[model samples]
Target chain A: MMNKPFENAIDAHGPTVLRVCRAVLGMTPDADDAWSETFLAALRAWPDLPDDTNVEAWLVRVAQRKTVDVIRARSRQPVPVDELPTSIAGTDGIPHEADPDLWSAVASLPERQRLAVAYHYVGGLPHKETAALIGGTTEAVRRAAADGITRLRTTYGASAAQEGTR
Target chain B: MMDTNNTPEFDLASALTVGADEMDSLRSELARRAADDNLLDVTYRTIDTPLGQLLLAATERGLVRVAYEREEFDRVLDTIAQRVSARILRTPARLDDVARELDEYFTGRRTTFDLALDHSLSSGFRAEVQRSLPSIAYGHTASYGEIAALVGRPRAVRAVGTACATNPLPIVVPCHRVVRSDGSYGGYVGGVDAKTKLLTMEGAA
Candidate 1:
């Protein structure tokens, strides 16, 4: 099988993976850590990848596993004493350019709906593939993503538009 | 069945998009992390030269492949991936020194490259003959027969010609200095016109 250099894979899909991580885990060290871990894992597996592999889908799958690992690790850690309250406006506890309100709205989504949105919308995977990543039928995954979007619109869609599409 | 597509449109990706600068830094950071972990097998970048865009690829060992634009960079990358390792990236940081040296050489401010060389792309007699090319000096030309003799096989002039024609590292290794017995530019991997331009630039023609 003719494999491409792993760098091409990184260039083509790194931003999408980072976006998915941030959308799912927030723009925190957790997201950055997940992104790094995902690519490092991909780089290790890149050489032997089949020529017909859909690289973006593969990376998003890897990112899902990495994100899950981060989440499990976080659950075991004691909350920091100086942790910022989740209700704060204009801050997701990180100095990123994205609207904290929108992220907060995304954060407010149920686990299944949030994952479905992050994978199918932000990660740019089709419903079938996203279903495979998060465990459901394609129809269920599609409904979860739509429900997540409808929730976000009712919650913080005004701030997202006011902030202007970045 | 709920109409999933009928939900009011919201641009989630645009709202969540990382800025271009942030993406650049993230990629650079990952490259650094990969290098530190020994996961980056080949890092490459392109530099514009008087001839054309030159594709420079390196391993942790050293600079390995220098290819001309006409070489179809994609094909060259495929060759390196197959012959070396498939773990290659287009990172400029590893090639900064070589790019600087090439710039200096093209402007006549530098006479030789001080960068480490990687000869993994060539082997056996061809590698040996190419290894002997750097000693040919700037602003000078040597015959194929002379190079064969220099490599301790005077009767292997044809082999020397093959070596020069296939030198994986060209201008850096100074294969342009090898001429025909009758004082003509026999062949060059970068094409004969590029050979002449390099010779004229070196004032060897």
Candidate 2:
């Protein structure tokens, strides 16, 4: 099998993986880490991958694994408020309207819902492939994506309308 | 909500947008990681000259291939990737010195190439032909018949012509210095116009 050069794989799938990561990981340093790690790992294992493989789907799978690792690693750490004085940033009863951002809205979702929405909405994967990546049936992922989008429209989508395409 | 046929209601899809800056940084990081892990076996970039853009490639050994713009650089790179190694990158810094030297050559500031070369593309009689080219002098021309005899195969002038035709390092190896016995500018790997250009620059035209 004639292997396509790995650089072509990067060009084709890098942005899609980045979008999926930003959705699931919320545009933080963690998102950048997930993007870099996915490509790095792909380069190392690239020669062995089947030539006819769906490269974007392969990269998204790696990004999903890396994103979950970052989240798990972050969750294991103590909350920042636990270490700081209570008087600092508002950690408790934070106002409903303070940070009405898409990132926070996405962050508020359960992990599976966030990933399902990200894979389908941003990565533009079909519900079947998104379900396969997330270890759920297509019907479950479909409902999760709809639920996630509905919540975003109610919360962040209002700001999007007010702000108009920033 | 820009609802149209097969469109979703919420415009939150744009929120997941990734910028070109992010992609650039990611690509550079991938190049760096590939180099550090010893996976990037080939690096290539293109240089612009009075003739046109020239594609330059290098392996860990030295400069490997230099192609004219007319050669369809994408196909050249693909062939190199298949023949040499699939670990290819279009990183310009890897060819910075070579490009600088080429700039000097075209501008008439330098004549000799102070760089390493990979002659894997030519071997046996052909490699001997390439190795024989430098002695033709910087501003002198030699006939293919002359080169054929120099490589000790006096009857192999056609082989000498083939060697010049397939020279992987054209300018550096000075393949343009070899011409027809009648002193006409001969076919160049970069085409006849490029040969005339190089020879004219060298004071041989």
Clashing pairs in 2: none
Candidate 2 DockQ, CA atoms: 0.28
**Which candidate leads in TM-score?**
1
What candidate 2 gets wrong by more than 4 Å, as runs, is A76-110, A149-166, B1-5, B8-17
Q: Residues B1-205, candidate 1: write the lDDT tens digits.
A: 5455554465677666566556665666778888888898999999999999999999888899999998899899988988998888777666899999999999999999998988999999999999999999999999999999999999999999899888888899999999998988988999999999999999999
Give the alpha carbon lDDT tens digit for every residue of A12-113 in model 2.
777778768777776566777899888878877776787788788778888989988987888798874122111112223333222336666777787677
* lDDT score at residue B147, model 1, on the 0-100 scale: 90
Report the C-alpha lDDT of model 2 over B1-205, residue by residue, as the tens digit: 4222144555555554545555665666767887898877778888889989999988888999999887888778777767776667777556788999999999999888999888776679899999889888878999999999998999999999999998888898899999999999779889999999889889999
TM-score of 2: 0.82
What TM-score does the predicted chain A of each candidate obtain versus native chain A?
Answer: 0.79, 0.72
Docking class of 1: medium
